[model samples]
Target: MHTTTEESVRGCPDCGSEIRVHSRFSAWCAACDWNVDPAPPEERPGRLARAQRAQARRHGEKLLTELTAGGTLRPRRDASSVLAYALALAVHAVTLAVAGAGIGFLIRGWGGFGMVPGTLLLALAWSLRPRLTRLPTDVPVLRRADAPELFTLVDQVAVVVGTRGVDAIAVDSSINASVATYGIGGRRLLTLGLPLWEILTPQQRIALLGHELGHYSNGDTRHGQVVATAYRSLVTWEYFFHPYSDVTLLTMTVNVFYALPRWILLGLLLLLDRLTLRGAQRSEYLADRMAARAGSTEAAAELFDWLLVSESAEVTLMREANGSALRGRGGSGRDDERIDGLWERLAADLRSVPEHERERQRRASIRRGHSVDSTHPPTWLRQTALRIGPPVPPAVVSETGRELRIGAELAGVRKTVARRILHDGYGN
Candidate 1:
């Protein structure tokens, strides 16, 4: 796909090696990587972030070793899992204790000065209360009646993965997809990012669905309501008790008083994170297995390849938005038509990426220990595990006509998302 014409080929500035221009990528030296990453490397993370990453990597490596040795992969109630649940229960108990204390203060005060502290304590308890995941109001929600074809495909995948089907689907402009439980009834919602969805082949799309829906059955500790809400409460406590940096003596004294509780909360948060880390990592691998089972090993592996290119996809989208804006400002294009065929152009660009460049990106990911997030193993490791694991035939298949219907269902929201990106710029 990347043809090297005289105009597109030049010697690298740093190593003097031949570099070929790519339409959607930076032309960098293959030998020296003169400009491979174009964007400046991100600033080093803080100490805590670094520590967390290190722990995740270590845990991921251990899991990978176990799996590669033919160890069974299933969620089990190990000591860490038990401890994690106990800690979550402890967190909830603390909140209840605080609420009881607040009630006692209110009863004892009965309209005296004590009422002030009672009210404050009650407010703190309210702030720390467990919260259910809520459906985002900003995105479009598509029910089964509205997008029967899409829901049907999702339902098929769910059956293959042995989980209950989602109650609704949410569409957004993000480059990722996820599943979450929302409301008191715990309804399942699948959020599809149109940018990612449009670029995927129908089978790849099924793989994406399989991966997300797989989370529901994979025993991800972080996704469970109790642990999730406990984490949130700890975050709230950390924020409230965070030390002020002001230099005044009064502020210093207040910080000293806040320091002990803040440290204690931080310790609990880290301990919970540590306890759940192994289970969280295992769940991701299990989800990947579910994806392979539902969509075939080939499609699942290709899905990870697509993920490796998502950063480039994001950069391309931003560039497209900027170009459209400049064209509008220069009167070279009508405002209404600025974003026309945007998704088409993006898919075309990504599909045209040459194999060599893809390999280069894969190698880059390995060198950098890149992952989807802290919870996931490195992309290379996941890909490797899929290859080493038992071969899986697709349990859920995509039909061409159904794929078309699903696209048709998403058409209107695609336009709205395009306009939002053009007006607000990418990554808003």
Candidate 2:
């Protein structure tokens, strides 16, 4: 039996506060509530365990803070945002200068016409606002439950990653979700699309949300927007000053004048395209890793598959609108040169596995898969990733029948509106 004496009631040795010993081996401090125990014979927590516990505590605290809304965790993006804006603006200016200088030699009126188009392009580029300072607005929906569940997932992921809840979630029939952060000051908004709500399970959705949150947290969103804005400006400049339509018209008409210079400018446009596509592919890969880290790898893969399918649908829709000419825009053709080696390399990496071994792995993955990757890699490449593992965790599948039912109702509402508006408007 463990004995107790007046010594047992002595103050805690650790804090010099009054303590009561319940057992001979352990004492509890009344003031600090510190639990004191006899020194271990020889065993103690090692460094790794101590570090892990500390990490766990920190992670837990982070989650709690997001949930309760009393944490000091705001996205710290000052230097990166400034750098992104500066670099983007500088690049845009340089491109305009080069194009302007080139066109200046062609015009007779002191080269003022050269500057006109270039200045217009610069203005267009400057119009796309930075994503960090916009206020958020929630998308309205008849299905109230889906919104709350969506909030739950957002909250959970925000907690894990240590960020604020998403700024807004929007509903659209289009099967796509983009992670965007915009605005100038403290009013930055993060927006999500409703297509994600239809496609992703709660867990997978959280994983996806976590990826977006990662972009916001890492200041990647601001950087991406800057790049996109700059690229858009470049496109605007190209279209206004050196339009393909104008070049074609000039080739047919008496104005064979613009055709030769337009052909030369075409090379520059192609080069810019190649660079932009490469940058987009790399940025996508980084976002995928962020999702994987925050949630299951399976969810990332599923999300990728979903994205590929979604893109295919979008391509089909575009083709319907424009005709067969628009078909297979991203497949082999002029566009293939834009993606350059990315698709070919990804396809090789994914398709090189032996057939039988691949089939076995595919079967296993069907039973328990990794989530989707964010980037919509080549279709064949995505199929390979799917065969290797599930796109989402088994836990992500844990959804109540209620959520499924609600999702169905939301789908019905979407269809009803689309039938009345889109189907009628398009005369389909």
Candidate 3:
């Protein structure tokens, strides 16, 4: 087995996998596929800058090791994190309250020229409000009868994780798994990306689902959105705070007074944002731990590792398939299963590559290492966290069981989801 290494050594900063040295000055990460190349010798960081960064990494590594020492992953309520969130909420609430009051005063003709300032402030507040940028998914929701076996597995995992059943479940063409809570209380939507599902065995699928549910169990989804809304509200004033404005010169001059304070407020909000994001990353670790405990630790790690391969292969398939369609090469017939066939071929192609070649591809997938702003921790950190306790025996449901229960029933649901994805993307 390949051994894991410390981040202090030659490891990819993004996912912490051992880096393959490409030359004297360049390297790549095998786990997340992040590329790293040193600047020209004259342009490299100074000794002090390098030392400071090294010390900072060591400090971060030390903190994670301590927090996760026992390996029974649990959500931590850090004082700094709580304070940051509280402050974010307070900031946004104050902004809305002030702007609303000002607008109300203007409505009543409480001030003449003052209404201009009120208009500007209220506009700024409205602009900064968190936008619902993520459009609703058009994929078909899977019902129990639609995929009885798969729904059974979801129910089983939900019980194990001590949560109520999902209100709705969906399948998508992307290689990701996510859950969101929306509408009135208790309404939740759990999305299972088919690309990720296809590459994962049934056990890993269970772990993956458990992880998504854990986000709910930990209340990360709703609380995260709450905190994010605060930052977005603050960001909205950016357009108004700039040098130009359509308002009267008097109002413009008054608004000029907000320039420095605007940047200062933004700075503080950004600092809080960093702390809040760190808390979010911790939340991911907690979810990963829950998935390991409720499902299978081994499978959880494998799910992330396999994503390195499957995600890239998925893109390749989509690109080629879309290209083929452009050439007027329509799919054979209703029985052809074009998307599924294309994915299978792509997956097979990836599997057939030499180990060395696979490693290179894996490294290419990386964007960068862990950052304070990322909601998820590095993949290696997650793997290490999940492996903390005594080994748990993995579940051993046979292929026959899986096939009779869920596998045979998924085709119809899968086709509907794929059709929706195609319609939404290509209008075909």
Candidate 4:
């Protein structure tokens, strides 16, 4: 009574019923979400053929993973760390000597000498620490159970990669997260900022964890930590030696002689900061590729955008707070607000530029000197890199799986190291 037509009915691969497919390569049955790709096109393959193919694929994957694993620890000789330490130490020492000379002048009841420099150095330490400075926290070690919402995502990803979850994830007030390995064969610590959690989505959070783990997996954590320790050791010396310096300027005739050395010290510190930022940005890019390779492009992109937003917000809040705090402090309120304004203005300028142009500017800054002072790359470059995907071979899926495994081992090592460092001491 009726004739079938191609427009009215299409062959259903699964149920073999006449059903319409709305899109090309529609693998799901309309009535059921039955996947169709693995279905045999002809007679089902015999057991022997399937077994041999499966075994060969598994063997090949194992071999590839082993080969790549060996390459992960290859030393990436980034000289920025060495340069930064040298610069920081030189600057710090000079600044301390000048401050000490001022102290010497004060002790001798001079018209001027020690009071200003002593006040400046003391003010620098007090104003910067805990609030504005990048000092490590003395808060109790944070357990995963304490912040289940944040740590769960980290743990889930670590589980997938086969690593023990982090021992503790710190929540700094800053807008960054960093992984540190104390020394050779030491424990690792992953410091997460409270601001970062507020800005990132669950998937993005997972991707970030993956990225950090990538650094650990590739032995970047250990290298970075060794360099960081040397830097910190120098800073400690600056703090300690400033008060003990030979600033016995018992004469007002010799005050200007010390200012030059102080200025040099400040300049060197700034240079070190810039160099550190450059190395950090490159490491961040490497982590981004690792995250993407693990199948989370969307997560990485979203995270990058969120980080940019958080940074913008932080800049805004710091400016507003500084305005209120220093309203009567001789307009040194201007100094506090200057850095905030610089970042806010830079972020605004970036918004006005085209995405690609902004990316070029960011990269150029890294090449000239490290413009990003955080432990992450610029958001624009990170987002752009995610769009490009990992540059590895097409067996990238297997590589992803392998990375996951390596990440797990690395995470376990990190957690163990972190516990030791936090509970014991860095030297221990």
Best by TM-score: 1
Going through the candidates in order, what is the number of backbone clashes in each?
0, 34, 9, 10
Tens digits of per-residue lDDT for model 1 on 1-428? Answer: 22232337789999899888765556777888776666544634755556567777888889889878988788666899889999999999999999998889989986697788888889999999999999889889999999998888999999998897999889998989999999999999999999999899988888888889999998888889999999999999999998887789999999999999988988898899899998888888888888998998999999888888998788778987887667665453665555667788788878877775787687677767778876578888888888885688888888889988988988888888888887778988
Candidate 1 vs 4: which has more TM-score: 1
* Candidate 2 per-residue C-alpha lDDT over 133-211 given as tens digits, one digit per residue, 9 for 90 to 100: 3443323333235556555556666666556765555454455555554554443344544433444665667567666
What lDDT score goes with residue 153 in model 3?
Answer: 72
TM-score of each candidate structure, all chains considered together: 0.91, 0.46, 0.70, 0.42
For candidate 3, which ten residues in a row score worst on lDDT? 35-44
Whole-model lDDT, candidate 1? Answer: 0.84
Clashing residue pairs for model 3: 13-369, 14-368, 14-369, 32-366, 33-363, 33-366, 34-366, 128-233, 128-236
Candidate ranking under TM-score, highest first, comes to 1, 3, 2, 4
Q: Note each model's CA RMSD in angstroms.
A: 3.0, 23.3, 8.4, 21.2
Q: Which ten residues in a row have the lowest lDDT in candidate 4?
A: 126-135
Model 4 local distance difference test score: 0.47
Candidate 3 global lDDT:
0.60
Give the per-residue lDDT of model 3 (tens digit) for 57-172: 44445546876664333567677677877877787788778778668757876548668777876776666665543425666676666776676677777777767667677776
**Residue 178 miss distance in model 3 (angstroms):** 1.3
Residue 101 lDDT, candidate 2, scale 0-100: 51
- Runs in model 4 with CA error above 4 Å? 1-75, 78-141, 144-156, 159-164, 181-185, 219-223, 236-279, 311-377, 390-428
